[model samples]
Target: MGELNQIPLKTDVLIVGGGCTGVGIFRDLALHGVDCLLIDAKDFASQTSSASSKMLHGGIRYLESFDFALVKEALHEKNLWLKLAPNLCQELPFYLPVYWESKYPFLWMTKVALKTYDFLSGFQNSAHKILRAKETILKLPGIKKEGLKGAGVYYDAIVDDAKLTLECLYDSLLEPNANAFNYTKIDKVEAFGDSYKAELTNTLTGEKNSIIAKKVVFATGPFSDDLLMNLGFSWKNRLLPTKGSHLWIRKNSLDIPYPLVLQTFDGRIIFVIPQRDAILVGTTEIQAKGDFFDLKCSEEEIDYLLKNLQEFFPAAGVSRKDILSTFAGIRPLVKKEGGNAHNTSREHQVFRPGKNLYVIFGGKYTTFRVMGREISSEIVHGFGGTYNPGTTLQALRQPSVFPTFTPWELSEQAVLESLSHEKVRTFSDLIHRRMGLLSLSNWNHKKSFVDFFTGMLDDMSRYIIVNKAEITKFWP
Candidate 1:
């Protein structure tokens, strides 16, 4: 029935969810020689993981809420990511322009917080800086000078989120016993005595299967509550599900030379990062009600981002008409109720809702490796096993330098001209992923380039989207 692939299989651990947290756990457990199986309902990193602001930093904004612990841990983890995945993550310089009326005008506050972040990071001080306002504007010529008190220059990083997740999956595949399958859903996870069994179905083929494992983990993010609801244990309601939407614009190449995290009029920080040929900006944190897949950039959010960009780059005078693309994702923040949204806690929690089941919640992308390590360590300890505490840290310390891949040298003409023969899966992927063209003139040329590429790829005689309805035959 239902093309059953009903085969008996067993493992030491079974991990659910394929986002940063789950993948982190997958990598850590695999490295420790723990046999495991991991699956995702959709493609890896396609959900909230794909929707991040694309930053790898010590949550510098967390200082407003005084989340020192999260800042320290995330800051340290930032270094780890840059170290292990040099191809996907790199240091990005950030400038904060101080205005006369802004609440965070004092340079001292910025310095103190950065110093603490640097200290906690131990030896990872390459991404920390303090620059004067004039010096900052010199690097960011587009910065608004009206009432400009000065500025503070600092360091952080920009990352390719989807690629990073893919790297984790690739690393996990290194373990012969470990496997990751996309478009596979976990239909059920029921405890049968001291062990648990999972019912898994391949969404593509309508195949049914099951596996037995000694331990099960639920690393689902915003959906953590719904997944736990069936077990009769209510989650702590830790996440507020704040929606963050971003816009990628193709502004004319300005002398403005560095990644910027400018403060908006409403006290929110918006990033104007300069990738190769374009500049990317955005992130509006509006409390959301729908699931992650349906998230999109609204008109209001778009206008808000434009207004903030104008404030910083008055001469640039960016507007909606200038935007090439937009994206949105919901942040799974711990619920703070009436407390300030920016002040919410980012500390993650691990729970045992049922026998041999563990759930992780409220983890940030920056600290995913540590989160994974901690969860795996707990699982091992729970099973009366022991592992080297420094395994994950050591993994991070290892260098992964690729001598051939170079981003700075690649030209837009060369990239598109090369991909002209390739098929288009979606417009977003073309603009955001393929050539990594964004709003920055260096990163993205413009929608014109995208339109040209579309024409270049429109020859469907070379590619096809096959589904069951169109298929006359099936292959096993």
Candidate 2:
């Protein structure tokens, strides 16, 4: 909630990213009474964090790689979040459809996998079921009936990732010593005498400031390799940086009651999830070749998702025209020699490029809390502070004004509350992330639904700066 001009000149810890991981660390350290400042080059969760497939699950497929530890760790976190942030995350059933020609065609194999998945969660997850082929068809209308062999029903969770991250950051700000700014970029960092001086520039208003910290942590996800290289740090390219994209279509497009996991021709799994008014489909894994920031879904990736969707739901009649919008994000998977992006480990690695600097990358969103603890505990201990990993087990103290995955009537008071408390600095920040409106299609739908806010520009200007140009971008 602090303005860019009000950033403190010094802190005990300075975190250089505002994604889930960074915010998670901020909350953990702040809870332990550490003075911390977090900054982001853009709005919180505007990049990879917001562009996720919106699922928080123990990677069932990771079992193939014998990643039981990672899967178990992630499953525990997934279940914990369901209890900690029920308003922002929910448990959902996911169906793995198997065909006669499928790799794991036998129902027993899938049943065993589901049982193992449940056991990994210490049997905390929802009960698993083995649906007969007829039951699978009955549950999933319009599903491809050819060679159908049944489905394994298991439970995972779907989350409002951006809102959850924002809530975490907000919870951290409850500490008087904790502060954060979005649209603030760290231009340079100089280490001097057991401390680091970081120069930051406000991208929106072009304001400059400097902060001194005893320790600096970079929770920069996919941007790690480029940022480190540009900062003149002696860093190897540790990131595989795979791009995953998703598509949002009308919920009526596919009539499945639960999320369907489809195996692509190339042996990758794609999820078709129905979320309220929209059906979410996605995720193509390809090595990122260009700029990873603010990435868009490529035509080829879109085609790949569509092909898989059509293959799984031959009678669904899903097409390019059905896509309401698309989003893409780069996953910062740690590079493993001779390992493809899909097979790379989701385990995160922490590096100390200097005595006072730490960098973490290559973890899934589900395990962000544990990742935060891994680094924060070290940094907090280095500062001579007692770190209690259990402090973060409590529920988030700050919740988003507009909670996601639920419907509520928009109001002037809600907009004002978001602007005053949720760090709504820009028009795009308000619409695209905080409000969970991803694209123009969402705006159009909302506009037709009701006159949500009257004198909207005038109303917003009372809380934060707004102009006709920004308003026109949405309405025009």
| lDDT by residue for model 1 (28-90), tens | 887787877777776667678888888888877887777778888888778877777787888
Model 1 residue 360 distance off true place after TM-score fit, in angstroms: 0.6
Q: How close is candidate 1 to the true structure, as a TM-score?
A: 0.83
Regions of model 2 farther than 4 Å from truth: 1-5, 439-454
Give the per-residue lDDT digits (tens) of candidate 2, residues 1-476: 43444888899999999999899899999888888999999999888899888889999999888899999999999999999999988898899999887877899999889999999999999999999999998988789899998999999998888999999998888887788999899999888677888999998899999989899999999998899989889998989989999999877778887888887678888998888678889888988876888998989988999898888888888899889889999998888899788889999999999887899988899999999999889978887888888999999988888878678666778878888888888877887777877542464455542344436777788766777666655665
Task: Tell me the lDDT of candidate 1.
Answer: 0.69
Considering every candidate listed, which one attains the maximal lDDT? Answer: 2
